[model samples]
Each structure stands twice: as structure tokens, then as C-alpha cells.
Target: MAATIGTETGAVLVNPAARNRAAAGLRSIVLPLGLALFVLVAWQTYVTVANIPSVILPSPISIAKYIVARYDILLIHAIPTTVESAVGFLLALALGVLLAILITYSEVAREALYPNLVFFQLIPKIALAPLFIIWLGIGSTSRIAFSVFIAFFPVVIATTAGFLSVDKGILRLCRSLTATEWQVFTSVRFPSALPHIFSGMKIAITLAIIGVIIGEFITAQAGLGYLIIFATARADTEVSMAAIVVLCICGLLLYGLVAVAEMIANRFYSADSR
Candidate 1:
């Protein structure tokens, strides 16, 4: 492809930086995929040759077949978990950012709330999952609320750091230029904070899913977590593994969407992406 354009000698003028970026991206995807494929193949071969019982450790192939056989049922359980995680993540994102903004801009907020945030972040949220069920009942409300609680702090911390990270000299220049608070925020603070915000979001998304799964485990009504628990209770290893694989795929897709958003935000705010 590099030979298709630009060079007088029938070779294209290639960008070394762009080529390096492309290579890095390819490796990022391919290496993990290669490792996983190798591990699965090794696992399958060992299990088959050893005559291992499926109940003990089902082969990846068995898990895939189980998923194919029970995809409809699996999907039904997965949807609720996905929806709960998404709803909670969005709520956490909004509240976390708003609170982060407050804490960053207001000394009173920082003094009053930041310490409390740290305290909650340190607490064992898993232990509190049952408390949510007691408060909100055995429903999606409890699941979503629990997830929001789990995911909120990272966003606040990252965003506050991002907002405060800009050079003090830059802010001084903006003030000297008669920029209003809104103008400085819109033109500088938000754009500069996008990278860190996305960083926190990537982390929060995973935790949000975990929170929902914990709720599902406790509630035992629906979701892949429930399926996993139910299947494991009956010694259906294949079903449990299949449910786990589906959960992993769902999580990867959600995280990928966040990554895509980060890319879009970076491109749009190109000047401040760094």
C-alpha cells in the first residue's frame, strides 16, 4: 500500500509516526487474541487427552457449544445486567462529574465532601449490596443504585485532577485576557479534562458491571450472574462458563464503546487531548 502513492521511485511517502501507530494498534489487539487462542487450545487438548470431566473444567469448545445452544436464554439474562450497568454508569458519570466540578471549583465542597468520598471509596461496597436490596427491594432499582455507588468515585477523582492539571500561568493568561468563567471553562477546562474523564469512565464501566452482577448474585432473580450461580449450584460447568464468556464479551463491547468515545472526544478537542 505504501508503494501506491507519493514517491517518484514508485513508492509512497509514508509517515513513520502513522505507520508506528498502526503497528502498535495491531499488536495491541493481536497479541492478547493470540495468547487467549493458544491458552484455549492448550486447555481443550489437555482436557480431552486427560479425559477430564466437564463438571470439573469444561473445555472452551464445550463452553462455546453451550453458548450456541442456549444463546436465547443467555441473551435474555444478559440484557437486564447490561441495561442496569449502563443506566447506573450514566447516572454515575453525570453525578460524578458534577460533583467533581464542584469540588474542583469550590473549596467548601472540597473540604466537606472529598474526605467523605475517600471514606466511601475505601469501604467494602460488596458488603453493602444487601443493604441496597433492603432499601430498594429485590429489583433493578437496587442493582442500578448499587452500581452507581460503586462507579462514582473514580470519575470524580480523575476529573478533579484533570481540571486542576492545567498550568496556573494558562489560567492567569485567560484572566488577563478578560475571559469570563464560562468562557475559560468551555474553551480550556472541559477540553483539557476530557482524557482523564474518559480514563475514569473506562474504569467505572467495569466496576458498574461488577456492581450489577453482585446485586444479581444476591437477588438471584435474573442476569448472567444469576445464571452462573444457578448453573454452578446444579454442577453445570458448561453453562456457567458460557455465561461468563458472554459477560466478558458484553463488557468488552461496552469498554470499546467508551474507548471510541474517547477517540472522538480527543479528535474534536485535538488541541487539548494531551
Candidate 2:
């Protein structure tokens, strides 16, 4: 009888937590979809009622139709942009983390580079687009390099902040225990910095896409950015909107991948700690 009562108590304690997690997951999906549907409906109605010219603003329905009609072309262009963005983001992440470690460990590096980073941040990054094209010659090489440049700063700043945010008491404890710098850093600093690193990565992913699109806009060779520019120039607003919708989908997929990786890493870290 006692064991039965204990079993019932455990279920009571566990069930609500599971239910709440499920509820939260459902809300995350439902809310965004519901809101998007509402916006699309309103947009379609307004365009239809006002008899707005397609050149000025294509209805959402028109965009959907265009997507269905030319999905093959869109897919082909999407491949290059997606590759550039992902590769650039990964490169930026690696270099940024390395630089952050240098800055955190060496006071000289912090003093020498941090101010210069700030100065570079103040400069209009877009103005460098033409220069990148001139240097890299309107190729994916330029796009990827430009993206790395754009996305690099945030990761460095966030990761450095994360490294510095470790508890002073923990450092003192490690020192008292005679833990080496590498051991302390690997066990403590990097683990604590994971959250900040992921934050920077999320932001970097979006900025990476923006950089690639901007490059494509200038190059006008391929990618959804090129598609948008081409369609707009031709006054085919539906096609432009279609390209934008696909671009957005691609961006969201990349962001979702990052989020999934974060979740997996967090789980592994937690398991390792236990």
C-alpha cells in the first residue's frame, strides 16, 4: 500500500512538468503560424479590394502561385546562397572564437584589437561591399569572405563577455586546487561561455544570410537575392515576393538547425556534468 501511494505521488509530481513542456512546444509552433496566416489573409484581401496593381504590390496568393510555377529555378538559386551563408557563418564562428580566446587570455591583444574592432564597427559595412567585389571579383569567394567579416564581431564580443563573466570565486577555488590554466579554462570557462556563444551564432546566422544576399544583389549572377533584383527590375513583383518567401524559408531552416545543435550540445553538457 505504501509503495502504491509513493508511485502515485511520483506521477503527480512528473505529469504536470511534462504537460507544461508539451504545451510550450505547441504554443511555439501554433502562435507563429496563426499570426502569419492572419497577416497573409489581410494582405490578400487588401490587395484584392483595393485593386492594387501587381507591379506595386503582388498579393500573397500571386506569390504562392509564382513559387509553385518556378520552384525549380528558385531551388537552384537557393543552393548557392545557402552554401555561402552556412560556410561563411561557420568560418566566422571559428575565427571569432579563436580571437576571443586570444583577447581574453592576453591583455595586450585586448587593448590592441578591441578599440580597432569598435572603430571598424563604426564604419559603414555596406560601403565595403563594392570593395569586396573589386577585390574578390563578384564571386562566391567574395560573398563568403564578406559574410565572415560581417558576422565575426558579434561572436567575439559575446564570447569574450561570457569568458569574463565566470565567477571569481570559482577561479580562486581552481587556483587553490592547483588546477592548470588549460584545465580550468576547458572545464569552466568554455562551458559557461556556451550560452553566449550560441547567442552570437544565432545573430551571426541571420547576418551571414544578409551578407550573401547583398553580395548576390551586386553580382547579379545567382541566388534568391539575384532573383529578387531581377524580378523587381522587370516589374514582376509576384516573382520577387516568391523569391523573398523562399529566402525567408531558407533562413529559418538555418536558424532552426542552429537551435537544434544548441539543444543537443546543452543536453550533452548537462549529461556530462551529471
Candidate 3:
């Protein structure tokens, strides 16, 4: 009877252990891939079963074929969009960080500028894209400038919050040690704010892409946004879907770059602490 009880207990424990091992092995790749496959299958089945018009909603297979056929055309349009997004994101990063530092260090600047910034942020900035075109002309410059304008706000807000979040005790200690303001900022405030700054950066990158797309929608001779508009006008839903898919890929690639940079920054800071 004791042997039977022990055997049952062992079986219960071993079963869970085996299940956990299987779950852990599958969690990262298999589960997500399986779910994505299921969704695609369902989507395909619905389109087929419903006899959906390809012009209204193309099947995933049709979109795939469209992408393959128009690969070169998509690449050509994607290049300008990628360039505009990258340039705008970089500009936003530099301007946002600089303005954040200014606002953090100067009480007068913060009082005068922060409220206005918040006000602008609350407004619909996308609505200002046409104004940017009027001011800068309908060129890549306008698109890039508009992109930078919309993407700049989140970084400033995040960075200012981070700068404010530094422990006051640390600042007092640094002052007692007769550390210069620059020294305190670099050694303490900047490092502490990195995570927040990166968080803002991630948000800004996505906004930057959105800004460029909107700009393209308003006035663009080329880009994925232009391709989407062009395809939609022709009632080529498959082509539109293909362009959208490429745009998503581009956006993901940009976001992934920021994520990689954040990971590297975190590792560097961790090593510095050690």
C-alpha cells in the first residue's frame, strides 16, 4: 500500500515536470507561430467560403502573389519612406534630448516652454501636415519636418520625467562632494534617465513612421503610402495589401533597431555599475 502511494505521487510530480519542460520549449517560437498559422488559415477559409470579391478583400495568397510580382515597385517606393522616417527620427532624438536637458536645468525655460509643449501635444498634430507642406513645399523636406514635429514631444516628456525622478539624496551627496553640475548630470541623472529615454524613443520611432505616412498620404509622388493610395484607387486590394505589408515590415525593422539599441544601452549601464 505504501509502495502504491509513492508510485502515484511520483507519477503526479513527473507528469507536471514533463509538461513544464514541453511548455518551456514551445513558449518562445512554436506557440506564436502556431497561433499565427491558425489565424491565417481562418482568414483564408473565410474569404474562400464567403466568395469575397478580390477587389474588396483579397486573400492572403493573392496578396502574397501581388507582393512577389510587384516586389521591385514596392522597394522603389519604400526607399524614400525609409529615408524620411530615419532622418526625422534622428532629428527628433537630438532635438528632444537637447530640449529636455534645457527644460530640466532651467526653471524659467520649464515654466515658459513645458505648458506650451503640452498644449501642442494635446492638439491634433496630423492636421498640421498640410500646413507643413504650405510652409516647406511638397517635398521630402516637408515630410521629414512634419515627422520630426510629431515625434519630438514624447521624448521630451519622458526625459523630463526621468530627470525629475533622480533621487534627491544623490544630488545632495554630489553637491556635498563639490561635484560640478555637469559631473552630477552625467554620472547620475543621465544614466538613471536612460531607460525612460529609451521608452520614449520607442514611442517616437513609431510616431515618426506614422508622421511620414501621413505626409505621404497628403502629398507624395512616391513611397509605400503613395503605393497604397495608388493601389486602392485602382481597386487593386491585393496590391494595396502588399504595400501595407511592406510598410509594416519597414516599421517593424525601425522599431527593432531602437529595441536593439535599448538592449545595448541597458547592458552598457549594467556593466558600468559593476
Candidate 4:
């Protein structure tokens, strides 16, 4: 009888522990979704009760309807923006990595360029969009170039910081092993600095989208930015909101791609280490 009681008590405690673990797993997915639904419901109720003008503040339902009705138009404008942003992001990544390598490998280059790089980063980048328009014209060229310009700094700074952050002892060990400069960098410095580099790349990806949007605002004849500007001019808040929602989706998709790349790279390095 005592043994049976002990087994029953253990089962009771273990069941709750398993239940609690299950609840914890569900919480991560449930909480955010619940909150978002609550906010949408509240927003819809408030707009209905207040009799708010759709032009001023469209409800979530109205925005959803607008998006569905105008999906084709939005897609047409979204493609150019996506292409320009992707191009700018890739260019910034290449230039940033190359410049960071130069700065890391050459003391003379670092001394000459690092200060200037920081200075440029400190300046208001948006103000330079017009200058790019003047140089590259009111075309996709200007938008892409401007986006690259704004996105380049974070990558360079982040990558340079990563390269410099590697342990000196590890570097010394590599050197003692008769590792060549290229081998040392590829095997030790580059791998170690990847986290920082990816950190910068994430920031650069977002900034690239912003840069392209700003360029479209200033001069583009196409793109989601143009759509937003056009809709706002007509006081079509629903359309503008729809465009913004689409833009947010694009940004998220781009950022997710970079994040996946980072995860894969990290996994590769982890496997190599083993």
C-alpha cells in the first residue's frame, strides 16, 4: 500500500511537470498571436464606435480589403523596389567586406580610411540622396546607388570590429603552426568575426530598404514609395496603409533571408570546428 501511494504521488508530480513544459512551448506562439488578435479586434471596435473617417484612420478590415483588391497593383510596384534593394544590399555587402579586409590587413589603410569612414557614417545620409540623383539621375541607378551608400557603413564597421575581436592567442597559435596569412584569416579571423559581420549585415539589409524608399520618395517614378506618396497626396489612407504593409512584408522577407544565411554559416563553422 505504501509503495502504491509513492508511485501515485510521483505520477501526479511528473504529469504537472510535463503539462507545464507543454504550456511553456505553446506560450511563445500563443501570446503574440493572441495579443495581435486582441489589438485588431480593439482597433476595429474603436473605429466603428468612433465613426472614424476611413480617409483618416481605416480599420484593419478596410486595410485587408484594400490589400486584397489591389494586390496586383501593389505587386507591380513592389518588384522594382525589391530588385533595387537587393542589388544595393549585395553591393554594400561586397564593398563592405572588401574594405573591412583592407582595413584589417593594412595598418596604413586603416589609419588613412577608418576615421573618414566613421565621419561619413556620422553624417546625415538621407541628405545625400539628392546628390546621388544629380550624379546618377532620376532612375533605378540613383536609387540603387543611394541605397548602397547608406547600407555600406554598418557592414564595414561591423566586419572590421569582428576581425579585430578575434583572440590574439589563437592568432599566435595559427602563426606558430606556420599558417599563411590567407589561411590564418580564412580559418581563424573570418570565422570568428562572422557573428559581428552578420550583425552588421542585418542592419545593412534594413537600411538598404529604407534607402531605396527614400530615393523613391525623392525621385522615382515607380516602386512602393511612389505608391505611398501618390496615395497620401489623394488622402487615400487605406491605399497608403496597404502599400506600407506590403513594404513591411518585403523588409521582413529580406531580413529573414539574411538571418537564414547567418544560421547556415554558423552551422557550417560549427561542423568544421568539430
Best by lDDT, which number?
Answer: 4
What TM-score does structure 2 among the candidates reach? 0.87
Least accurate 10 contiguous residues by lDDT in model 2: 265-274
RMSD of each: 4.6, 6.0, 3.9, 4.0
Task: After the best TM-score superposition of candidate 2, give how far the Cα of residue 86 lies from its true spot, in angstroms.
Answer: 0.4
The residue-by-residue lDDT of candidate 2 on 162-261, one tens digit each, is 8999889999999999999999899989998899999999999999999999999999588999988998999988888899999999999999999999
What are the TM-scores, per candidate, against the unseen true structure?
A: 0.88, 0.87, 0.90, 0.91
If both were scored by lDDT, which would come out higher, candidate 1 or candidate 2? 2
- lDDT at 17, model 1: 69
- Model 1, position 163, has a per-residue lDDT of 92
Which of the two, 3 or 4, has more TM-score? 4
Candidate 1 versus the native: TM-score?
0.88
| True-structure RMSD for candidate 2 | 6.0
Model 1 per-residue lDDT tens digits across residues 98-151:
998999889999999999999988899899999999999998999999999999
State the lDDT of candidate 4 residue by residue for 93-131, as single tens digits. Answer: 999999999999999999999999989989998999999
Pairwise lDDT winner, candidates 1 and 4: 4
CA lDDT of each prediction against the hidden true structure: 0.90, 0.91, 0.92, 0.94
Q: How accurate locally is residue 112 in candidate 3, as Cα lDDT from 0 to 100?
A: 98
Residue by residue across 130-174, what tens digits does model 3's lDDT show?
Answer: 999999999999999999999999999999998989999999999
